[model samples]
Target: MSSDESQQRRGSYVPIDFTPEVSKQCLKQVEFYFSEFNFPYDKFLRMTAEKNDGWVPIGTIATFNRMKKFRPVEKVVEALRTSKILAVSEDGENVKRIEPLDLEGTKNARHERNKRTVAVMNFPHENVTNMTELQEKMEEFFGKLAQINQVRLRRERGRKFNGTVIVEFKDLPECEKFLKTYSGEDAETLSFEGRKLDVFTKKQFDLQREATRGKNFSGSGQKARSFTGHRKNMPQQEQKDENKEEQKEETSKEEETKVEDKD
Candidate 1:
């Protein structure tokens, strides 16, 4: 394309000031956004990857509402360069996982993730404008309190932030430490943004949710089954191997039709 054409294409783009802090946050957000734990239920990203053999354009990733603030597309691509889980394309225009996603493995991942996660509620939802912002704000808040892996904001059917979040820590010890210090008797006095907080272990959260919604509340697990091929529980060894082969074949087909985006 001509220089004028290229300039016109990017005319509407407004770049943000990139700094070390912005870079760190960008990498953290993108890494978790594509991590095995979040990818399965990430419908939009899954769709985009399916179109290009798991390779998603950096431009596309930068378009995400949360990532938009980390602007100048080059900065987004640069931050991903050091990622241990993501790999940039040879042409440096797109990015994908370093290895094909192990769909079956996500079952065990979710189990492990739950082991070190805690549910934090009553966050003053009216202050949360979007899920991305909520994740950022919560991550910052929780990071100061403990070593954390990710903070997922629970949302309602209409995509409204419900003032509840499930926070996963880097390890069981950190998780337990946070819970022991903040929950039970201490929870009464602990407040966030001036509002009292409700903290619960994963088990407690599930029980409370079930109690309020009745015994049939399956949560997002049931919803995630579609992407996971309904393997809610572990499968036989032979079946698992067979599914891996099938997944490989599907990925191969997607790669065969890979199309590079001009933008």
Candidate 2:
């Protein structure tokens, strides 16, 4: 093989799942940084995330690197985001503000400090066994999680509330009890009461909720870029869904602010 070809095959290879052109280009750049300059990929990823307000859009990332678009570089980025070395400075959207989980130095300490909330994904909208079965199960599911500040399981008439349950614990130790018994990977799905549920911190849920708004992740004072890296047309129905959620969120905030002002 040629020298350049040999480099492509060296310490890094493009993923087969990506489109050939995009993957090849991404790998070429990463190989240059990793092998030629010996630049650390993790630091680059952290910078990318910081630039885009804690969420790195694959296409935007390419633009920042002066590379081409049409490349789904998120898979390659996944390597960096999943790295243990990076630090998260702030949060943005689900795709934003991931600093909640991406903090560099004390990921464990930060996670421990995030005792305020726990996310339960793929939870039943309503327990079939009993109308209030979910609430009852929650009370006993974890020995102490039952003593939470509040439980939010949002649902619409026909649509499930993403089947996610955000539970706020009463204190740090209570959360530690829950985490020690069930925590896995970031937002790992755990089995509970005959149902499979993805679990994450309240902070992670904040990231997800922020991403749901369909807002641009560009940092303050920066122009927002299209979120879909490949510029694929987002379905009309999906767009409408995001708008509805955003509207509800805004209305809730406005009312809360009004009440606070009244107080």
Candidate 3:
């Protein structure tokens, strides 16, 4: 045979073999199934060999078969008796015999942890020229949220006008409920001063250092004091004037009586 032809045949007949990385991956999959079924390492190896069609199984079929056999009513009971399966129970009632590495509570935990919270929303597109109008619109929008305990609204004046609103709820759950209801709705979209409404959490407000700005200081703080002081002084001044008038009437009556007696 020619040298070139010999080289070609040798190259074509190279034997296919699993690399070290592929072998490691197969072993890892086997270990994963073993842990999932809470089966002991020795029994897991046996089951893997039996169910894999003798091809060094590494896939869903092996895992599924292991899970099926290790269920509560299946071979899991025998495994537990022999101390080959790890048995976990909730509240000492229902024992779950499976691998500790299995993600049994993952779905429920993810759902609960993904909940959202209520936050302040800025409406910059709606033509709210004054603070009163901005506050009125905010109250109108938030009135739908029955869970909202209080709302403090304010407006900032600068080159770009912006409004800030604070919404306080009874608890975190209520806040989360509100967010779920209104987070992605068309009616919740607000506009003021040519800017769209921006919603953010209380934490975000604190981070941006916008919490104390644009407060309702005049209405919330000194207005009540001024009204009360005016009311107090008004009653006392009216009483003094009334007493003076009464004294003049009494003196005039006495003088008229004396003149009549003289006559």
Q: Which candidate is the best by TM-score?
A: 1
Please give the RMSD to the true structure for each candidate, in Å: 9.8, 23.1, 33.4
TM-score of each: 0.70, 0.33, 0.28
In model 2, which regions exceed 4 Å deviation? 1-115, 126-131, 143-147, 157-162, 186-189, 214-263
**Which has the better lDDT: candidate 1, or candidate 2?**
1
Model 3 agreement with the true structure over 1-263: per-residue lDDT tens digits? 99999975543322223344543433332343334222222233435445643222222222332232222222232222333333323222222234343343542332232233234444442454544344446656676665654454433333122345566564678776665555544436444445454455544333233223244322123322322223332222222354554453233223211001111
Worst 10 residues of 1 by lDDT: 253-262
Q: Write the per-residue lDDT of candidate 2 for residues 22-68, one digit (tens) a residue.
A: 55555554333222111221355457656765554543334432233
Clash totals in order = 0, 10, 7
Candidate 2 structure, TM-score to reference: 0.33
Q: What C-alpha lDDT values do all the predictions have? A: 0.65, 0.43, 0.37
**How do the residues 1-263 of candidate 1 rate in per-residue lDDT, one tens digit apiece?**
99999976764367877788888888887886677756665656788898998998887777666666776778788888978889998777998888777766774466577779887767777655555555566778989999987676665544556666778899999998888888765443557879767677775554344334423222323322221233333222322354664454343222211111113
lDDT of 1 at 176: 88
TM-score ranking, high to low:
1, 2, 3
